[model samples]
Target: MPFVLYAPVKDGLHDPSIAKQVTAFLSKLFQDDTTPGLHIEPINNAVDPKVRTGRVTQMYRAVLFKLVSDGVPHYVFTGVWPHDKAIEVASKAVLKMNPVNGLPELIMASEVDLTPVVERVARVPVASVAAEFPFLEYKSPGLTLAGLTEELGLDPDVAEHAWVATSEDEVMELAGKLGGWRGEALLELAVGATIADVRISLGMDTAPTVEAEAVEDEQLVSAMRTPTAQMQFAWLEDQEELRRVIEGGDLAAWRIFLHPEQRKYVEAAYGGSFRLSGGAGTGKTVVLLHRARMLAKRNPQARILLTTYTRNLADGMKRSLRDLDPSLVLADAPGKPGIYVAGVDQAASQVLGSASRDELAAAVEAVLGIGGNRATSRTSSAQKAWRDAIESVGGDLGPELRSPTFFDAEYDSVVLAQHITTLDEFLRVRRPGRGVALGRLQRQAVWEVIRSYRSSAAVAGAVDFGEVCAIAAQLAASGPIADHVLVDEGQDLTPPRWQFLRAVVPEGPDDLFVAEDSQQRIYGQRVVLGRHGIKIVGRSRRLTLNYRTTAQVLRFATSVLAGENFVDLDDEATDDTGYRSARSGPVPIRVATGSITEELDRAAAQLAEWLAAGAARDGIGILVRDQRMVERVARGLEDRDVRVRQVSKSAATGKDPQLMTMHRAKGMEFTHVLIFGANADLLPAAYLLKDLPEEERADLLQRERSLFYVAATRARDELVVMWEGKASDFLDAFTAKDHVR
Candidate 1:
């Protein structure tokens, strides 16, 4: 008969030192030839032949099936598994089996300490043994066998056999003898014997089980009788206590509520794909960072892929990750498994190579009727001449070309028209190819156009950054690079981008985590991850806690998003540990005159005051609607002797005034915020009045709402919302309630 040794320890399997010792002990037993047919399987970290991880439940289920199928009298080790449900299931499976012909003798080897099992079972100690293990230290010296039996409430005679093992060899010998008890008999014995009884029988004396500890911690003589009254009264008292703690922080409470729910969700959803959709200031990036950290801890071998629409955001995320864990190696992490942070086109181009880049540029230039070498003065003149010839050939340049808009203001109409014509031609080239090859070329052309518009260095750098996603999607959908694709900002993706992501990932719901919120999309675009067969596994969870902003800041900002799907924490009654509030900060919102000069003066004055009050210059931000506005503000602030950092989409460097467009300010926090150009055409016009359908118009409105949400929440202690001309239409509805003077 195979014997079973039940060694329960206080620590869990996560302890590397303890786990190693357990593995060593098991290895010794399995290696002994006398222990025939004894197979010791350490399930933790043991890879499944099919799956890559040894996930506890899967292994236990396999073990039960094998026990029933083979009917071998083998010895199985069970100590490292964590979840109680898995243990319960395994125990019940053993009870159901007929011991004579089915199932093996299970030996649960643990550090001679039984505090963990005692805590789990809420029982007392019954036995003790003097065995030296490097990982454990026994605190209760000179503990007697009689004392153990009395503490556990176990019958002394039945518990006598528990202390039979004096050394490692004897423990193994004893484990083999008790391995094969029948189902009903084992159940009866387990129920009759408390953890104390088992410990005394196993030769441990001073083990304090769960029941004993509970008795020692709480007095048994409490006068309260009714359970409901005790529970209700206690809950009310706890709430009152929590309210006091929250109120003490005053305006800084919201940041405290930000992490708990986020951590819980990430823990539950670890190693799986799911979407995280929320409005701006809902802690999406915070959750993503925390999720990355947790995933790093759980699956150390898995690589992490972090990509964003812009190069700046990607760089920012990489910096933030480094801040969170300095030792993290981004290059070797999982899912290709390390950190590859770049814009979508940059990533795709890296994979697709120069041939694709050249083809795309050629297509873009051919369609635009521009010279191939537009970067050169000669090539630029040639393009101008070619555009004039096209116009001479009756190519009616549209009204948009003749009349300048925000984007066309800096360039001549003929030049703009040439680029437009080129884009149209490139689209036409890929229209017939339609499948994988066409998609790749179309994607390449999109990026090529953007690159050409943005830079003179390469065709890929001339087009606008937005077009990069379109091209990457094409390559992902139908090219060799379509094996595994991960996308961030799923909500901001356009329809074509969604199609591209769908075409790349493997066919299943479990393969993707589409995290996007319709309300938080500030780009005014519509793309559904689920519509394209991406499996959305669970309900969208709301992360309403504001970790970056204080209670006052959260209140003012959340008021704007009020009727939308959001969770508003009473930030005034919460606490965010380790974050300090500005000592003499003004109420976050400020309304000033529409004049650019007047606004700049007031902004400069406020900034000087903040700096004098000890706010770090680096922590202050001046946000605007466009690059032109940024330059205007920078010049105004610099003239006043206030050093400024200008962070423009195009400029890419510098540390004066931190002049940033509203979109780039997402996922960043500032101690003080000064928002300029809240005027109608500038604030909402960039997105609101485009030549798109009514549905698209509504989508833009939602995006605008989210954009404002982002701007308002960026302020940790102070916020100022100012405008120059007619106020934005977005503020009209809110302005009625004295929100703006």
Candidate 2:
């Protein structure tokens, strides 16, 4: 029997044929490494004599480094490639343990070429280059160049190559090519981490004493079992696990490679409610999924509700949870003792649908203060009732109060939030976030408007989703519905939805887990969880290290919110102070054209370029501001002979390039993203800001900025923003003289 450890690929493993071949190879290798079909032969003249290539198929091969541990044969499978490429990789690759961190790192010995780096540096003054590349500043007596080579275990040649880089981008390019811990270390240093900081980040404080230069390979094998090494390597114990990993590919890797910070949150036992906040791609949702699994595995009969703000995201989470662990039961109802995944609206519908007619009527009366036997149905537009109400009874209201937007915000944030069902209760409400204070007479007028709205909705037998949620909260408060509840995309959850979730699961140990980022709150208003009965004051954590988006993309995404102040669920203002990225890639591309047609043409051309460069159509996304633009862009792309499918309430099913509105793109990621129609009039959508008080207008603009940030951060590797005429004011952050600073 042989021991096999699999290394994850940074880019996803998407080729079905290659995946099948890798699966076959791993199965055979686990059976017997000496099997002739595997062709596990050592490379001739390799950097490490133990480096070898195993046959995957006639045309493909797997790169492995052979080792012996406790007299048992062990093989570390790095990746699979074409036969020639595998041979080349095997010739140059070596597995060595980092002295500072005591973690095994795989690096190519023959990858660096000093000639081009030195030539690039010669064009600029050495002092200027040194200042531009922070890695060059690690020349202190405590952390000297010699320390980088000897103490830190960096290859002398590679260290010199990085030190002579002329710019941060140049070093990033080098990091991309190096592709391992060496690249990771160089990236951290280039983005302003001291050598000592890198060590600490890698858990060097607990450095083991495994000697790197031990004559026997057993010591090197021992180093692979270290905590830091486990982050990058995982042992495949059986054929079933290997097959699952081979099939799951990148997602399987995500399940295995959680950072220490994320692992802490996932594994921690909380006394009550907890909140996890981070920017997009900071692994907040990842932690949620892992935590759900941990809780389920700990108690097999626990009834958990894994939910989010929308149906599409919730559906996606259910699928991902199945992938993470298939044996965990999935329940359709609340009390079935399994993870029930649903959007908040769906959950509310389930709760309401299960109630008796009398119970349902009482619940509706509790929320709306009216009696009707008509079952609630989804409305074409929740705003339509408000518009009708304002038209019929809002005659005496001032100009500002005439808008349906004003009524919607006031009703949800104040009326529904405080459970106000009477004229006097509405009049006496504080209306904290209402921007403009209302007089007693004005409050009476608003109550009349609300009454009219409720009457009309009752006559039509249609209730808005928010009302459904409020009714569900009332119905569920009679008894516990779930043992535990987990919320993703929590910032976009409104107060009623929060109340419903709180009522679904009683307050107790590990009762509620919410993952949110205030900067991505593109849909709902700012909600304070404490006000909604789910307190997270003492049980909150923020994850600042982004693992999904590259540093270049992260910087551009974050710049959109550079000066805007955002509040977490606790209502405390938050900052992105310690936020950073674990990887680096090319800067985002920005294009401004004279007309929408030209913008569409340029976007189509960029798509062609990416396709020609081997990008997958399924991995590309074109995000727009509105559903109309989504359809228009899909038509335009079709006219240009590009395959595109418009995404609405569900995840795009096929592999054709997805065209979605910015709001629809939430909780989704892509390899390359093109945010289209980011023009001056389109992004804030003109209508949202047309007729509003100054405070409301400012708040709406902040939400729009958050929407843009969410869309921009979806791209994992590349981002391109296309606009007609002038770009959105949000892009001004990238245009100012000191923008890059």
TM values, all candidates: 0.50, 0.89
Q: How much does each candidate deviate from the true structure in C-alpha RMSD? A: 21.4, 3.7
Candidate 1 per-residue lDDT, tens place, 1-741, comes to 322122111222233434333344334443451353233333343222111111323222112111111232222223344445333333332212111122212222232233332243224322354335110112233334564355433234323433432322222222223322211111122223333433333222322222423321111111011121111011111222323222323222222223334545554542434666554455576566555666566666544455555567767767766655555657522125545556544554443342365655554354334434221122223233323332443223332222112122112212222233444444544221011232444334333433344343234233332233333443444433322234556555544344435544555323444545554567523433444455554444554333456545655565565555421111011122212111213345557575878777778887888789987777888788767777787788889888887775566555444668888887677888888778877767564355333323444556666677678778877887888767766554443344454
Per-residue lDDT value at 146 in model 2 = 71
- Which 10-residue span in candidate 1 carries the lowest summed lDDT? 228-237
Which candidate gets the maximum TM-score versus the true structure? 2
Candidate 2: 10-residue stretch with minimal lDDT: 132-141
lDDT of 1: 0.43
Cα misplacement distance, residue 267 of candidate 2 (Å): 2.5
Cα lDDT tens digits for candidate 2, 1-741: 989887644432336668877888888889899887899998887888988888888888888888887788888888877788778877988787666556677765345344766676667655543564343463332445675676566778777777677566667666666655566666666656667776766565665676646644676677666555666677775887788888876656776666656777888899999999998898988888989999888998999999999888998899888877777788997777889999999998899889999999998888888898546765567677778898899888888778778887887788888899999898778877668788999999989999999888888887788888888899999998999999999999888898899999999999999999999988867888998899889888888777789888888888888789898998888866557776677778888788878887898898999999999988998999998888888888888888887887654579888889898889899999999998989878898775576668877888999999999999999999888887888888775343221
Clashes of 2: 0
TM-score of 1: 0.50
State the displacement of the C-alpha of residue 562, model 1, in Å, after optimal TM-score superposition.
Answer: 6.7
Native-vs-model 2 lDDT? 0.80
